[model samples]
Target: MNTVEWSETLLLDFPPMDEVHHTFVDLLALAQAAPDETLPQAWSAVIDHTVRHFGNEDDWMRRTRFAAADNHIMQHKVVLNVMREGLGLARAGNMAAVREMAGELAVWFAKHTQTLDAALALHMRSVQSDAPARRTNRANEHPVSAP
Candidate 1:
């Protein structure tokens, strides 16, 4: 089975996202290489990281009002749900199902990172860049309630 190795190509240029994604990649690597005896634990680790990673991104999207937030969030929901299903499969002695899901996830991740996630990073950068400007302009504008 092909594993998704972390590399420069996967860097989203957003530190927080990158860090989370790095952890995810590493955890996923462990799952990919795990022997049958430990595959469940390794896969569980990946799922744990994924829960947080996807939550953070989804939160950012909603907070930043990213244009595609709904679509992006739905994708996250679907992927996460499918991954969760793999856990049940693993527990049910369906190791093969878990293995296949892991391979498919690797492929899904690379594409999702480059496309949906890349767009999110760009949107985040734009929002963050505008924040200071918005703050700076506050003093120059009409005060809502001067304190």
Candidate 2:
């Protein structure tokens, strides 16, 4: 099974996103290494993690108005649907399909991280950086009167 080994290159500076991504890599590895008897369960775990990961990132994109949101969300939906299909196939005694998809997913993950996820991380950084300043400005604007 071709696994997406986590490396510095895959690290986004954003801690929250990085943590989830690390979990994704670890889960993917587990799915790839799983024996035939346990492949369905292992693949299920990957699918669960991926669903949450994609949902969280998609939500972040919507909240921040990320420029590339449409494409990113569409990709997430498409990949997830395929993963669900693979899960069904695995459950129906077609573990080979899940194994094949695991490899393909590894390739897709790397490319998606480098492009869509990277952009979202940068947008998150910018949005977070501005948040504190905006709050400070608002505080100054509404100074309390002397008691």
User: Which candidate number has the best TM-score?
Assistant: 1
What is the lDDT of every predicted structure here? 0.87, 0.87
lDDT of 2 by residue, 11-97 (tens): 889888899999999999888988989999998999999989999998888877788999999999999999999999989999888
lDDT, candidate 2, at 127: 86
Instruction: Work out how many backbone clashes candidate 1 has.
Output: 0
Clashing pairs in 1: none
RMSD of each: 4.0, 5.0
Please give the range of 10 consecutive residues that has the lowest summed lDDT in model 2.
138-147
Model 2 scores a C-alpha lDDT of 0.87
The positional error of residue 12 in candidate 1, measured at the CA in angstroms, is: 1.4
TM-score to true structure, per model:
0.92, 0.91
| Model 2 spans with C-alpha error above 4 angstroms | 139-147
Error of 2 at 137 (Å): 2.7
Candidate 2 displacement at residue 28 in angstroms: 0.6
